[model samples]
Target: MIETVENRPQPKAAPLVVHVVRQFLPNRGGLEDVVANLARQTLKRGYRVRVVTLDSLFTTPDDKLPALETIDGIEVVRIPWTGSSRYPLAPQVFRHIGDADLIHVHAIDFFFDALAWSRLLHRKPMIVTTHGGFFHTKKFLAIKKVWFRTLTRLSAMAYRRVVCCSASDLNQFIQIVPDGIAIENGADIGKFADAASRRPERRIVTLGRFSVNKRLDHLLDAMTALAKRDAGWHLDILGAESDLDAADVRREIAVRSLEKSVSLMISPDNQTIRDVIAKASLFASASEYEGFGLVALEAMSAGLQPVLNSNEAYRVLAGRHEAIALADFTKPDAAADAIEDAYRKVATEGSALRESLMQAAHAYSWDAVAERYIDLYRSIEITI
Candidate 1:
């Protein structure tokens, strides 16, 4: 039952579309989810899908992933990388992509630039999905800006397509590459569809990486504010290790004296994560940046009210989905008020609100996204 948008004609031969990314599978996050879904959906369309990723997990560098494996009939190749996690160098990428008819690079990092830099050597039709443009953090803003406008723009020229994963990204990058198109990232919305409380209470849940851009500290601050107003307001944090670790989160919770009210589960299994989602009536995030705000949509799919920060992507989403609330996460009290309002709204609307949220989530599934990628891959007209 591989559902795809029809009408687009494919090439006479199946193209081996190789995906080059900084991380995948073992490292669960927005970017990883994007590449995985794209690879899986495209494979079902009869295109050859291959994912080439860095061998080491960014959070736990000491641990290494399998060098080769097959996931959902798609071949995955993991190559070693050296240097900062920000831009780990993996020149070995060229070795694996030799058989690829089209290369899809995710994130504008080391691989994105290097692959384009060495485009002549590989001699493959290439496209890249800009997953937020590396402006996720405030760190080195000036340096990154110069890099984006200069070197990054040059690199982008090598690719036939530059796909921005969010409208915010399109606005930021379109200045450099005017022809770029916005392709919203897809989420596994059914992962927790309508799994929340029957009449959603004051309980909340947040899931993702403990990355710096996630602004977990601000989220804790908001929880602290909410707890002061209603002791019953609890928060369950389900996330993987990233820039922040378990110890850092524990330290934060201890400072707020919220050991009982706030819970943390690092790298929990799917069912376990869903268990928290099942009990939560609200999902909140204090992130200052998101490429496409995929997790918020997933929370909404579970019938949980999303109280997200006023980031560009989130603001755009909230405009489309009225049930979603916006907040100034930098100001904990303001964020707490937004969360309170969301819970109140949930209490009033109940199943009606939940159904609407789930309906909104389905609008961005992988079906149409895969169709677009298929059309782009076939439009290459390059001989294999």
Candidate 2:
């Protein structure tokens, strides 16, 4: 059995740590999962946890969320916001976090800038986690670069700690804050620990948001190549629609005549996802960008070998973890070749590789990452 967060003795005075993010639950992506897992870890450390988020999801603005609610034992308060989702402006965060001992700003967006600018009024020790530093895409990148150096540089001064979630992020952020530290985004690895088959099949499974940056088109083409080679090769795509429309992906699957071999599941529950992946032996993704490639890591934790896009984070992870394979996702044959090679190894050395993959993922388990955050919180208490 995996060792979970140890139930530490409760503090005499539980300090509140409020997480400020652009969007939370009802949106199941990396940022949301990262914050939710951290909240759970802190709560286990005897800390009072709360989430302050926007009332509307940028994906579906017309659908409004509750103003207040509790999820997984964490209190959440939703605040209204306006402006582009890239940098949503929500000033109402001040009202919900007046009593917080520490304000944990997630991602590099408006919440990050807003709390940093109002440091004097809140007077809370703030720490910001750079979730890929908000440069996921190259659109308007010139303006983003200017903003990062100027306004973002000034905001870094207010943060007690600049927690860069990956080494890639560390390289980008350390220029602004010399003391920036690297922390692996903690994953609920145990949820699907050793969930894949002992002697797995040729089925390929990938899950996450169907964001354009994920390069779903490339993934479809890769699947097309695999299907042409062998009608037996199957692909399971499990994800919710983000900026990319679900209908577009479905239409592409039909256009490529891959509906027979490729299966798609939208926003499945935790158990449902686990069940689907359990039947598959290999995992693959064509994502061109990632904060830390948490889904790929999560799949690794499940004893599934990953064939990932050659993005910086995936390249670094593939470097550190031998179980992962990197491929040129833009080239469909290259991606298909990588996927085929991974399955070949899975068939030949499935049990040994599965164990090795699971062992490697344990290093990034929530049990370890959360301990790092708890230590940081304790250190901050002294200065508070």
Candidate 3:
């Protein structure tokens, strides 16, 4: 059994720590959430955790850096980057990380940072977590994929340990670096449970940024088909929309005449998103690929059935259970069939499904996931 940080007493001496990432502080993505939770849990275990991140989308120049702040008893240091891109070449970041016992880099796309830190701060044990590459076929063209693959390969070689959020993500890295570790992602089950109880109505909801890879269009298409068959069906999409794709989605919705059936709401607070998922009759994701599908786990914990693609991440995280209604997107009738099946089952056997899903969801609490990371950290020989 995995021992959680809460189960073990804290060590008297504070362990030095540094977390390097492309972006942090105010970022809304999964990587930011993981780093924040890790910092907090490590601090709870009596370790000093400092974060070094580029002032990208989330952070601003007005944002103070080297400014020490405590979150859940952990000390965090937010830093600014001089480069234009989020993954900038900042040599100064390594300067702040020198005194730390271990330096954990959030994503491998920060190639320059990974290369510089590994070479300059050789004394520290460097761990890299590959949070999925931007080179997925759906997102990148042929030329872009080659460039990203090369960059990721170099970064993987420099890191002491490679960590992936799911086995699918680990498998992706294994093609480049075979000796990587698969660390399952976790969520706060209590918060999700609360959200579920407060949900608004029996509706279908999907949460993610409006991107091509997310296959939001496919979701709308599926909803359109469902509406033709059953006029009562409704779908809600909640996510941040890029100006480039917003027009396309709008055009597609109008063309399909799905304006009445599907509602598009832009990015909302985490609690608001959770509330939406909780009240939803079914949680649907049409992504072509996923590193871990954190949203699916969140929805399942809230007793909402997830309609996800039959991918390794979903298979491993969700397990071989009917709790998660798995669908193969490649199949012609997969989405429509799965949606109908899930809706019908939810109506007839809702209580039983919720109970089983809630039970399975218990395995993914933050405390349990944090313990796994701490165990990995302990197992590693930290020379610094």
**Deviation (Å) of 362 in candidate 3:** 1.3
**Model 1 misplaced regions, further than 4 Å:** 1-13, 382-384
lDDT of 3 by residue, 96-204 (tens): 7767677777775554345543674466677777676554345337765576567566666766778888777776778777798888777657766734533224478
Instruction: Tell me each candidate's TM-score.
Output: 0.95, 0.95, 0.83
If ranked by lDDT, best first, what sequence of candidates would result?
2, 1, 3
* Minimal lDDT window, size 10, model 2: 3-12
- Model 1 scores a TM of 0.95
Q: Which parts of model 2 have CA positions greater than 4 angstroms off?
A: 1-12
Candidate 1 local lDDT, 1-384, one digit each (tens): 553433333334787888999999877898888898898788677777789999989888889889997775668899998999998989888889887888999999998999889988788889999999889998999999999999999999999999998899999999999999878888887678778888668899999999888998999999999999989999999999899899998999999999989999999877888888888899998998898999998888888899999999999998998888999999999999999898989999988998899999999888978788778777874444
lDDT of 2 by residue, 126-189 (tens): 9989999878888889999999999999999999999999989998998888999999898778
lDDT of each: 0.88, 0.88, 0.69
Q: Which should have the higher lDDT, number 2 or number 3?
A: 2
